[model samples]
Target: MTIRVLIVDDSKTMQAVLRARLSREADIEVVATAGNAAEARQLMRELDPDVVTLDIEMPGMNGLDFLEKIMRLRPTPVIVVSSAAQAGTESAARALALGAVDCYAKADRFGAMGTEDNGKLASLIRQAAQIRFDQRAPSIPKVSVKTQKSIGGDTRLIAIGSSTGGVEALQILLRDFPADCPPTMIVQHINVNFAAAVARRLDSICKAKVLLAEPDMPIRRGQVYFAPGGDRHMMLGGTENWFVKLRQGDLVSGHRPSVDALFRSIAPKIRGHVVGVLMTGMGSDGARGLLEMAQAGATTIAQNEASCTVFGMPRAAIELGAAGVVAPLDRIAEHALSRAA
Candidate 1:
């Protein structure tokens, strides 16, 4: 099926470049091009495109403001396409929080749009087109932290894997965690460039200290270690004295910093002392490893379909008997903590 797309950017040159790139993809068609939020809104009312490519730095109503409006009213799938996203800036992370389905790093104003990323952007467009949005509140209300407490002795570590809709999911999940939560490890599939910004964004919101994992960094209570994106897979090291270890490797289950690698690594060493959570994502990256964790007697949880933006990862785990429990997104934090407690 053809995926109709709307291009919204202040620059005519960027519009042309995006149009040209998308034109090469037979299944993708640029239905409309708008220079600013006003024109974009008008086209949205008329075309109802399957996907939108939005530039954050637009005139008048900014891309973020317009994106919030779209999500609140029409609820359409939107991809933030901007140099701001490419730079792994705070604006890019904010776009995701505001309900953008994905972010595509585009060439800067003075830079040339490279040929290598054409097909990649097309792939993202195809994926975004398949998403269905509902007219609901754009943000999840932060959970009250007063009820939370420190982790139980049985739960030595908390490891989480997510992709696609993970940013928002993690935000909601972590907010409910106590200030002195267990040593938490997270692998959220993302653009390598955007990893730091995402970590920073999460740190600002959560009670626990959220940090990007560094090689050989010791696991500690009250901290959440986020895997660094790129060519290395983040794994657990030192059985009794656990630390984050980044290993250079080819893609495992189609991701470099794979969820499977992280889950599998922790399974044997920690055994029943771990709590594994596989949240909203596309594809089955964490299924097998989650099974391994379950087999090792670790408490394993999967996010249920009702709350997942895309239920692919969790569904795969559920089918494989990997998940010890399947829970809705809202209840996951409480449930996981209960298991740990």
Candidate 2:
């Protein structure tokens, strides 16, 4: 099936470059191109493309504002094409939080001529086109009192691993966690800037304090530490009582902040005193680690396929016999809380 794409950029040259790069992929068809948000909206209604390539900087209506509107009105998978500057990173991070599917940094030299390096652009377009879009409307699930509970003495930690659609799924799960929740560590497959933003966003939503994980930091209860992506693996270290380690290591399973790394560490360190949750993501990044946790007698839960944006990670865990339970997204928080209690 052809993946229909709409390109929205202020630069005519960028539009041409993107069109040319994507045209090489037989599965991708550039249905329309818009130079601005207004034109993009009009074309969106007319063309109804499967995906959109959006530029961060634009006149009249910026990409961020347009992204918000698109998510609220007509949800479509959006790949942000941004520069490599600091400002670009910040904007791209915000775009991810606003529900952009993915982001690609344009080549540094491309800024001078307003043209992209076709090679890199084509690679990104291929990846973006393969991403499965979640069209579910945004609505906060009603908070249930039954879903919130205190952690048990045996359940000393909560570890979560996710990728792809994990950003939105994590937001929903974290928002429901209580202030006194167990010490939680998350390994989300995402860009570096977006990882920090995700932690901050979770901090705002959940009562628990959320911060990016640092090397040799003490693991404190009721706090959440997020693993930052950029060629590093978050591990467990320090003394048994206050131990937590975030170390830089080789990429495992093609991911730096791999869920497998985190889960394996927890299995040997925390053992039976942990609760593991695997959420929606595109790949099998967490399956092996989750199995380690399960073998260690830790409680492991996989998000049900019906609620997952992409069932790859969780499905792998289930197939491996690593999951103790497979629950819907809305029920995952409650399940974790219950195990803790």
Candidate 3:
């Protein structure tokens, strides 16, 4: 099937560059282009594209506002394109929180561009086109309070891993957490530019205090730790009273702050004191690590297929017999809280 895409950017050069790069893919077709949000909205209706390549810094109706509108009205997958800089990162991350499906950071103007970068963009667009868009307010099944599982001990820690549709998925899951929830740590595959913004955004909405994890930062209850975006891996470490540590290393599971890295790091120390929750993502990064958690007697919960934006990671864990329980997005928080409490 042809993946029709609409390009929205104020800069004619970038728009042409994006269109040219994307057109190299056999299945992708650039149907239309727009210079701003108003033009983009009109083209979206006229072209009815499968996906959108959005620029965050457009004049008159910025990408973030436009993204929210698209999600509410049309609901197609959107890939945000921004510069590989700190300012660009904040806008892109905000776009994700507002419902963008993916983000791509461009190389600096003088930096040499490569085929691999273009290839990754095409791959993300294709994967997004294949996915069925998951809305925020779907028909929720009636949750039975009696169905809640009782975990035995005081929940010492919680670890979560996600990617792709994670921004919304994590928000949905974390909104249910109590103010005094367990010391939670998360590894969500996001661009380094927007990692801190994402944590701050979540901190504003969530009951728990969410902050980007710093090297040697001690972990404690009621505060949620987030892995920063970059070439470094965020892992759980420290012997007595755990702390988050960042390591510079080769990518694991195709990501620096990989779900696998987080899970593998926490595996040795969990020992029934932690709850591991692997949510919606497009890869098998956290599968093996979740198995380690389960083997270590920690309660492991995988988001069920019915409620997943993409079931790859959760399905991987379930197939590996790593998940102790499978729950929908809505019930995951409840289950995790029950297990932890």
Query: Highest lDDT among the candidates is held by which one?
Result: 1
Q: List the residue pairs that clash in candidate 3.
A: 192-229
**C-alpha lDDT (0 to 100) for residue 216 of candidate 1:** 97
What tens-digit string does per-residue lDDT give for candidate 3 at 28-139?
A: 9999999999999988888888999999888999888889888878888899988877667777767887768788876645565543463878988987886777543442
Best by TM-score: 1
TM-score of 1: 0.94
What C-alpha lDDT, on a 0 to 100 scale, does residue 5 get in candidate 3? 91
Tens digit of per-residue lDDT, candidate 1, span 1-341: 89999999999888888888888888999999999999999998999899999998888999999988987788888889867334546788888877677888886346658545648789888878767655222335557443364346567898999988788788888888777888999999887767888899999888899999999999999999999888999999997899999999999999989999999998889645688999988899999999999898888999988787778899999999999889877777776777532
Number of clashes found in candidate 2? 1
Error of 2 at 177 (Å): 1.4
Give candidate 2's error at residue 147 in angstroms. 3.1
For model 2, name the residue pairs that clash: 152-340
Please report, as a residue range, the 10-residue window in candidate 3 with the lowest summed lDDT: 139-148
What's the residue-level lDDT of 334 in candidate 2?
81
